[model samples]
Target: MIAEALITLSKPKVKISPFMKVSNSSNFQVSEFILKGLPGIYSWQHWLSPPLALLYLSSLGANLLILLTIQQEPSLHQPMYQFLGILSIVDMGLATTIVPKILAIFWFDAKAISLPECFSQIFAIHYFLAMESGIFLCMAFDRYVAICHPLHYPTIVTDSSVFKATVFMVLRNGLGVMPVPVLAAQRDYCSSNEIEHCLCSNLGVTSLACDDRRVNKICQLVIAWTLLGGDLCLIILSYALIIKSVLRMNSTKAATKALSTCSSHLILILFFYTSIVVLSVTHQAGRKFPLIPVLFNLLHNVIPPALNPIVYALRTKELRLGSLKLLRVHKEYR
Candidate 1:
């Protein structure tokens, strides 16, 4: 009886589910997570799939058209178009990183995401967003140089310089945003496997961690502000200088043309940053309406991408003409 009592004492008092695994440290780790997508609309969630998929398809189509237009047009082989091409690629990546999985959750009721996949999505989402911000900053600088120092623009914004800037943008954002997912994955997620958000955002996944997630939260905030906020500030400064230079132009026609060139970029910037600000405010204000923030987050990922090429095409004569020529050529070939 004493031996049996000792055996009983040796056994763990708590029951561990088969779904969870014991790590080397003997902590129960979650292997999968359930994404509770858009709270309080379970029955009608499927209705969202159509519109969401349409947005995704539209983003893909429009961005692809932009890329094709840039690639095929010899006249557009300039730094501006090159940066626009990069922006299109980043926008496509940003939308793709999360939207499909969201669609799956809505369409097929596939809400479970493996732990590794979830973390990967987290990394890709943040990485692409950072890249987009970096591209925007580069574009702003490009505009500033073109407008404020037209003579120096040719020397400063050369093809080689654009290539170097693109490389830097890729490397900086990749290295900078990598820590977010890595840090989130390191935390012990023993408390819950149900993520409240539609996607595996750093905050959404980390909030379920049983251990203190203050570090994760702090890391995300610091990285976000450092990357996104820093880029926005620099962009604002660039535009301010551009405006100052534009206002000084003696010819009103020249000033209007210069400002017209920047209008499309400014519109895109507003769309991207405004969505981010609204989402942040919604979260920080502790708004009781959960769906509002989720909708904003979804719109932020899809709307900018869908609108980017369209906005540029509508505002920029070169791109609009080039797109028409490309379509005509394709039609002729067919």
Candidate 2:
């Protein structure tokens, strides 16, 4: 009897209920994501750190200088410079959103990020890119008016107008990109918790999910075409009109002068769009080689920010002279 009692006591008791059942299905949600940094080139990650660190520092320092220059010089507080200031801020945001995390992964081997933070990074990436596109469109419009309608340019792009345009750009981009993170956050990631890219891009993270991510992909494409595509179209149209105005000028010198004013802006726009196109083509055609696209994506984020100040601020005569004067003043004070 003692032996039987001991056996009964040792037996596991099962709680059987209609509501509680064994689950064969997997849990398709994740609390954290492991960032797989450049899958095949783990050894080269440390090597990549030096150049990337240089770029991050250059972007931050250059953008900050431009911002401060504009703030100190009252004469430089025009519509075009104001837009460029906003662009600088956007570039800083773009660099900050990606570089620090990338550096941490490279230098410290810090790969894991919580889901909420990952989503926040993705949101910032998309938001800043959208803002850049919109600001480019505004700059194109500014150039068009300054060249095409010189008399009305000042009145048309007044301080109030610039303020309103800035607000619209922020609101439009912020609202338009709101759905991207939402869709991405709803994804089920049972198969993997590893994003195969350097940064938390929308498609990169969504591709890691186990469930159907068609909706997420579709939303991404829709937002891209809507924001980027629309901005490109408007910019092209503004340039077309500006070119038309320049051609109508009787003297070749006058026409050249008109086009010269737009040269810096055109150069910046060319760099911006060329990188974007290369990134797209790499994503589509270079799928067999993933690192190409990843490198381009990283460069695209950093290079433009690093070059913007050089192209827009330092290249312009007013800004260059003002920077020199400001430096002289600072030296005298010191």
Name model 2 segments beyond 4 Å from true.
1-24
Q: Please write out the lDDT profile of model 2 over residues 1-334, one tens digit for every residue.
A: 9999999899776543221222337633466788878857977887999998998898898788788888899988999889989999999999999999999999998999877788889889889988988999999999898988889987899989999999998999999998998888776666677777777887888887766889998898899889998998899999999988888899999898778778888888888887888898998854688888887888888788888887876568887777677778879999
RMSD to native for every prediction? Answer: 3.5, 5.8
Q: For model 2, what is the alpha-carbon lDDT of residue 311?
A: 80
lDDT of 1 by residue, 1-334 (tens): 9999999899766654432334566356677899989867877888988888989999999899999999999999999999999999998998888899998898788999987888899999899889988999999999999999999999999999999999998999999998898888887776578877789888888887777789898999999999999999999999999999998999999999999999999999998888899989877643587777777777777788889999999999999999999999999999
The C-alpha local distance difference test score for the whole of candidate 1 amounts to 0.88
lDDT of the candidates, in the order given:
0.88, 0.84
Name the top lDDT candidate: 1
TM-score of each: 0.92, 0.90
